[model samples]
Target: MAAAAPAGDDAVAVDVAGVVKSFPGVEALKGIDARILRGRLTGLVGPDGAGKTTLMRLMAGLMAPDAGTIRLAGVDVSHDRDRVAPSIGYMPQRFGLYEDLSVIENLRLYARLRGIAPRRAQPVFERLLGFTRLGPFTSRLAGRLSGGMKQKLGLACALMGTPGVLLLDEPGVGVDPVSRQDLWRMVEALTGEGMAVVWSTAYLDEAERCETVLLLNEGRLEYDGPPAGLTARLHDRSFRLAGPRRDRRQVLSEALGLPGVSDGVIQGDAVRLVLREGGTPDLLAPFAAETGARVEAVTPRFEDAFIDLLGGGPGGTSRLAERMDPVRLETEVTVSCRHLTRRFGTFTATEDVSFEVSRGEIFGLLGPNGAGKSTTFKMLCGLLRPSAGAAEVAGLDLRRATSEAKRQLGYMAQKFSLYGLLSVRQNLEFSAGVYGLEGRVRRARVEEMIETFQLGRHLTGAPGDLPLGYRQRLALACALMHRPPVLFLDEPTSGVDPITRREFWTHINGLVRKGVTVMVTTHFMDEAEYCDRVALMYRSKLIALDTPDALKARVVTRDLPEPTMEDAFIGLIEAHDADREAGA
Candidate 1:
């Protein structure tokens, strides 16, 4: 592999021309062409099955395109990938390191693979540890590290020999804002040193950080240039539509259905809106009178531009939610945790965490990874017994009546937790029977789920064979087969494209409208805004609990008048650290 660009080649580090990749039943990429130069960060973003991963793999020299050619550092990758392997650093989406090894061990192992001598690697190890702030955790097992720590360690490994080109695939998928910031800092620093980095991310905000962007959709290049060009299209078209905080869902639903509207979502107590061409506040006049809909123009974002570039937003209406029956409960309290604690040996995973969710409420549990949120979720879902205190679901005791309590809720895991070998129809049937549906009832429910989730065509295939969106649909269908009153979603939309996430939330919001209580654990700070109330966990304990707007308000100051959810999150954590330092 060539370390530097060829003479008079415009410093193009990666030259991709007319690239095409196809599967048995699908074409992942079609005639894609892009030039990524040295010392620049390029963002690759697209929808599910939109050829994002395929394009990334092709760019990394891991796969040869069915047609066209890719040149890495003046070398044709298809002709000689091995010749260029030493010049490229690629961090894949899954398991980039050994979980059983320690942080330092992973780095050393990669150093060995890259043939860096032990004495020379020592200084590199120290520098990377300082850069990633992982110096103190070098001896910690990779599996014991938090989500953010693991990503930072993976990035450190990828930079072992200081490769001239780097490809990161969804590195921040399930990482928290704090950790994501760290990862971005490292990538930006590398780019400053003349590294050409291609970052593929689901987070549109992250995409906007790149100097150039290659937007793909349906196997075609939709846009290729500065992200600002796309955002400029949305100038003066974004706004904040506010009413009663309690009516946020209803207001957003109505606003999304109005004519001349392009997009609408609940942000804090208001609906962040984007209007169609020639549309104005005048278009919102219909609902202004009754709901006192206040409108204030706001700056548009990269996500707005991305949505516009692809298509208009997925409408607020949900077909699947329309078919569900309203949940009926005698008590107001749907889920309750009182002084709940969990421990393994002497390590406390969760300590004295207490929260209550009411009927029809969307309760969000959020924190940095390893903050005990997962442990709390497991306790509430009846997967783990709390070392102390009480847990309840639909007024049934989760601690004592684990089976009965489990029957009251539908649990959808972050990984979609489907049986890999089982066909879609088989999985649905198994779920139906497990939930106690029988004979005609079981068959009828399975068929209804298939129709509602649009899984009929994919019935014969395993869930993994489907695209990410369809896999999510199947998982949700399996969870909701029995029509439980409560839903437990663990990062249900993590790593999914914006459109699929909007569709998922539409169904969730619709379910709440029909009286279904939801308890969700999410890494997405923006999604946390959708909750009626949120519980923020830290250091195995509850730190803050409030409405989204209230949480943001606590961090509001003269310098930060309009703070986002991520701002509030990072600000709150910093304040907590400051307070602890002062106390110490």
Candidate 2:
């Protein structure tokens, strides 16, 4: 219905009708249809494998639809993508970046390719560098930048040609809260200047900020309109419950299973469920009592409503930690480094970095895109050797006792690395064997892990067939097959729903209670609060180290409304940028 029209806007910038794309054995986009109005930021929201990326690639003319048409500024993009290429900028989920080249070098190359004269490009590049507050790091290799900075740099490069339409696919996935704010601010500024943006993300919060949102689930457009309209769907029909926290997922599941219940999803400590028309609490009372939950009426948020619409409500919460305590334990340092150095040619990926992660504690390493967090993590995990200095994990130097040190760690990288051909049980069994767990012990652990992670029903299915959240949980289960003393998670909860993120943490927290130390790297500031301690790194240096609240209190700024971890993070980084800028 023409997307119900935004509050007050008429100009249309992107028009796609009956778009359908298919691969060798996959229907990527099933007759997809959507639009982006002029001067407005439209969000393409979907879960992974929901055709969001495919649609974006089609719109950008990087891929063609089997049956449909796409137009940019009313000109057919599918037919004349080259002619309209100069007026469109498309940034894929994984934008190609050179590790060896400096930040400014990459910008210059893009400008030249876009036909910008040296003198003209110079001014624009300078302005972009300043806008992103990355001027001082111009000479730094792109590989050495932090995750947040890398995203910003990517954005800078995308805007080099001043495209009229910008298509960004999950640009803020692994970005910190402060950087996300900066990104949204930049988008707002561009839209104000009449640029149209089609931003895709798995984060509902980011989608809520868009002028209009297109909700995609399983290759179908579920909702395409304003966020207010989406929220309005629930109205008084939504309800919430908060009492003693008691396994909200389980409670919600049972509540929904009742005759009068329709849908439910857990939100933090509460379970927000929908009731049948004219349904009353008495209908749900027995279900709540049986599920060990105290029911109450609570307002549903956008996330809860979306989950309901998608029919992806929370299932029963497994009693994974029933025998174990839920509280995190504080123990002695399990991993320590002193003056650790790693270099590639003349560039230092990790320069004289030093830190210690306590045993049984959740320690978070926070940084921008290439702030050396991954380098340090690889060193500790014995994947890479340090160029100099000492690096010890589990009381043994990784370089000297790599095998022994590895036995003490269970590592989950940025993406779940599992064979798509293998079933969930097979993957777990393989991991168990690799970790030296064998015989009955191996079989028992594998079974336990699957049960704990709720893979029983999907055990026979290939790992690739599982949902993103399930895949993540399976990876975690595989990592813990050998019951390592320490777990190293690299962006464990990236690109997942907030509810799923919380569920993942619930399991991770369970591990902490069993004297298992967790050293994690993440871009989410809210996740930082869950950490026992946090370290903010920049340019291979540890700048801030403390509990989340303590770090928030340390960095003060007048312009920021609330002094959050995000505010402190940005203020600290900005000040460092200013100092370096002046020095440069």
Per-model lDDT: 0.87, 0.77
Off by over 4 Å in 1: 1-9, 244-246
Residue 260's lDDT within candidate 1 is 82
Candidate 1 — which pairs collide?
Answer: none
lDDT of 1 by residue, 1-584 (tens): 12443445667889999999999888989999999888889999988888988988887788999999999877988789889888888888884789999999999999999999998999999988998999999999999898899999998888878888888988998898888888888887888777899999888988988899999999999999999988998888888877743488888888888888898778977888889877887777667555777778888999988887776788888776788788899889999999999999999999999888999999998888888987898889999999999999999997678888888999998767999899999999999989999999899889888887778889999988887788888898899889899999988888889888888898899999999999998888889989999888888999999999999999999999989888988888889989999999
Candidate 1 weakest ten by summed lDDT: 1-10
- The TM-score between candidate 1 and the true structure equals 0.96
The CA lDDT at 349 in model 2 is 82
